[model samples]
Each structure stands twice: as structure tokens, then as C-alpha cells.
Target: MSYDPRRPGEDKSQRAQTRERDDAQVEKAHRPDALILHEIIRREGEEEMRRTALALSLSGFSAGLTMGFSLIVPGVLKGHLPHEPWADLIVSMGYSIGFLIVVLGRQQLFTENTVTPILPLLTERTSGAFLRVVRLWSIVLVANIVATIVIASVLAHTDAFKPEVREAFAEISRHTIEDPFWTTVIKAVFAGWLIALMVWILPATGSAAPFIIILMTWLVSMCGLAHIVAGSVDAYYLVATGEIDLAKYVTGFFVPTLLGNVVGGVTLVSVLNFGQVAPDMEGQDRVGV
Candidate 1:
């Protein structure tokens, strides 16, 4: 060991093998990167969706109840603010809280799931799986929206809200009534896009994703973006309180917002995500490889 200078060349191949083994050991010890996490989350999402279909009604009702925060938050915040535009921002932040919970908690949210299940269908799965996903999305979405409307109406009629909250609801209702149908639809499209983006990002971020979701969704609400399920609560509140006509709320707010959300999620986020991931997909022809 002390006279190694002249023998340095003797162990060259042995040293190289030792170094290679060391490198392999190091690589094995390293934590998983984004790609691995992505796969884990993708599979998790798929499994969640499968379970969600069976529990669709309960999930839809919970989504409705949770979505009511959208109406209540703005209404509550309006009481604190002096009838100014900035008050809307405060309320919108509150609205996003419910979404953050339902989504990050891995509870079934109708809109977000629309894009997820479709990805699997793009491959060679049976047509039945594709139809099942669609059926699940449609049922959950419809039930959620209906639940929101019903709850909102009850809250409005019962005067469960404080006087200040009632005033805020009325103020918020006026804006919905005043806006043109087309504008509501457009805003809803953008809102849905943001929500879908949140869904996409969540899989990549793991447990910490709720913060990102809260931020983006708050921005969506602050910017006056519309969301179908959440917005229905506000629309129905107007009808329940006798402040706005039911027909107008249905034709104007409900129809337009729902259409906009679908367009945003499916046409924007879902399609874009598919296009980005399509090239990377390999071994598709093989069965479950």
C-alpha cells in the first residue's frame, strides 16, 4: 500500500469497475424525479375516477354543498366592503377554498375529471370505458349543478343570511343579471381553463398542490371568470329571493356558463394536454405492457 506509485496502472480496470458500481449504487439511492411522480399520479387519478363513478350521487351532492361557498363568500365579504369593485376580489378568494378542498382532497369533482379519464381512452381501451367516463362526467356535473341551485335557493328564501349578507347577495345577483349572456359564457370558458390547469398541475405537485390551486382559482374568481357549478348557486339565489326571474337565470346564466365550462375544459386544457403527451407515448400497440 505504501509503494503504490509504480503499481498505479495495475488496478486501472479494477478501479473502473469499482467506480461503475459506485455510480450504479448512487443512482439507485436517488429519489424519484418528476416523470416517476407523474406516472404515480396519473394512475392514482385513473383509479380515483373508477371509484367515483360508483359514488357519483354522493359526490355530486357534496360538490353542490361545497360549491355554495362561492355564493356565500362574496355575499359575506360584500358586507365588509363599501359596495366597491374590490369587494368582489375578497369574495372570490373565499369561493376558491371549496374547489381546493374537493380537488386536492381527491374527492370527485365533475369538471376536473372530464379531462383525466379521456386520456386513457385515447389509447386502445374498449369503447365501453370511454362511454363510462363520459357518463360519469355527465351525471356528476348535472347533479352537482342541480344541488348547488337547490341549496342556494333554500339559503336565500330562509333568510339564513344576515342583512348585510343579503345585501351582498343582491348586489352580486345584479351583476349576473346585468351582464350579457355571451360575456358570461366567455368568462366561464376562461374559468374552466384555469380549473383544468389546476387539475393537471395537481398530479405533478403531490400534497403541496392545493396552494397552487388556491392561487390560480382565486385569480380566476378575481378576474370575474365564471364556473358552471359554483355560479349556479349565485344564479339560483336570485330566483329564490324573488330578485330575478327564473327563466332568465336559466337561459342566461345556467346554459351559457355550463357551455363555456365544457368548452374550456375539453377544447382548451384536455386537447392541449393530449397533444403535448401524444408524442411521448410508446408501446401503445402492446396490451398493457
Candidate 2:
């Protein structure tokens, strides 16, 4: 959640003046290479693993509740915009709002954990490490989904939003279930890939972290890709509104998207990113991951 939280912040000018003029120092000042990025995330994963179950669950819940903004913002956009191709494109950009909040706030998002924890699990390759990853995944995913379900119910039943906004929410939620099972699965693959990639690059983004989050998340929405957490808010809203049955929501959206996201995140991003960094990472300090 932090870029070495124990370390104090240093001014860019102060670091440039104080550090020796060397290649290593130069690398430190600029973008971190893939290996450095891996270590940074791996340490983050280690720190996450050390968190108590309650802390992880609460953070995950907060992320899920906040993720509702992605749906609400886009719905608000749609309510204001005339229905047109270009308008949809502009509305998709609003989908980044929730992601900006979650990522910037350092909340426990399930998609992010797909890559962050796996680096250490790959290096250790021990039963304990594998169990730890599973534990984190289970806790975070459940907490996120439950929170989404609760928020969806609140949106569906309450008069908290304008009628136009609520209608827009229902209209957008329908698209998530309109896709066939395999089609949704395929779309979710790209969603998972991009999200994990966002986490991977974040450690190197310096002050551009917010821009990167918005850009990558916008790509997902613009491409109509499925994301487990973000899409859940939409899908669950339909179920709560009685527009779709629970069985259809689960079979059509939940199952396919979940499988696709896990496959895309763990296989495409986590395994491959670690594979590229493995040779350089060998025999290095364990760093207690």
C-alpha cells in the first residue's frame, strides 16, 4: 500500500544533491526497472500478508463500497448526455472515478492483489507461502463482493439518487448480463490483465500514479471489458431491482467473469511478470516475503 512506508519522504532536489553521482543512484532517481518494481511490489505483498484478517477485510470492504462510484459516475454521465456513440465514449471515462479513489486511497482491491502477492509466492514456492496467498485472496474477494451486494441493494431500493440517475443505473446494469457466458469471460480477461498491469507499473510511476490509474481503468471501460469488482456493482444492481434473477446473474456474469479474471490476472500478469524478473531475483535477500 506504500512505497516503503518506513522510509521518510525526500525532496527530489535534495536527493539529487546529496546522493553520489552514480548509475545506481541515477536508477533510483528515475523509473524503477522491472526487477526493482518487482521487489517493491513483493515487499508490499509481504507487508499485506502480515496484516490481520480484520484489517484486510475492512480495507477490502472499503474498496468495494468506493468502487460503486465507477457505476454511479458513469450513470450520472449517461443521464446528462444524449444517447450517441461519442457520448458513450465520454461516459466511459467517468468509470475511472472509483478506481482513482481506491488506488489513491491505498484500499485493498482484489484485482491488485492478484499480482502483488504472487511475486513472493513465486519466489518462495513453499506451501506456507501458497496458503498465505490463498488466505489473502479469499478474505479480500469475499469482503469486496459482499460490500458490492450491500451497496447494490441500497441503490436499488433507496431514493437516494434522482430518478434519471436510477434509470441510467438500471440501463447500464443490463449490459453486463446481456453478454453470453464466454463473451463475458473473454472481456473479463482483458479487464484483469489491464488492472494487474496497472498495479505492476504503479511503483514506478512516481507522481503519475493517478494518471496511470485513470488511463488504464478508462481503457477497460472504453473497451467494454468486464472487471469482477466494478462489474459486480452493475450486475448486482439488476438483481436487486428484480430486472434479473439471481441465478442468471451468477451463471451469466459472476461465474464466467470470476474464472476469466483469475486466469487473466494470475496467468497473464503474475506468472509472466515474475518469470521476466526471476533470473535477476535469484539468490537475492529473501526480504522476508
Q: Global lDDT of each model?
A: 0.73, 0.90
How good is model 2 by TM-score? 0.89
Instruction: Give per-candidate clash totals.
Output: 0, 0
List, residue by residue over 110-131, the lDDT tens digit for candidate 1: 7776567665655436878777
For residues 194-224, could you state the per-residue lDDT of candidate 2 as single tens digits? 9999999998888999999999999999999
Q: What TM-score does each of the candidates earn? A: 0.80, 0.89
lDDT, model 2, position 151: 87
Task: Say which candidate scores most in lDDT.
Answer: 2
Position 70, candidate 1: lDDT: 69
Off by over 4 Å in 2: 1-25, 283-289
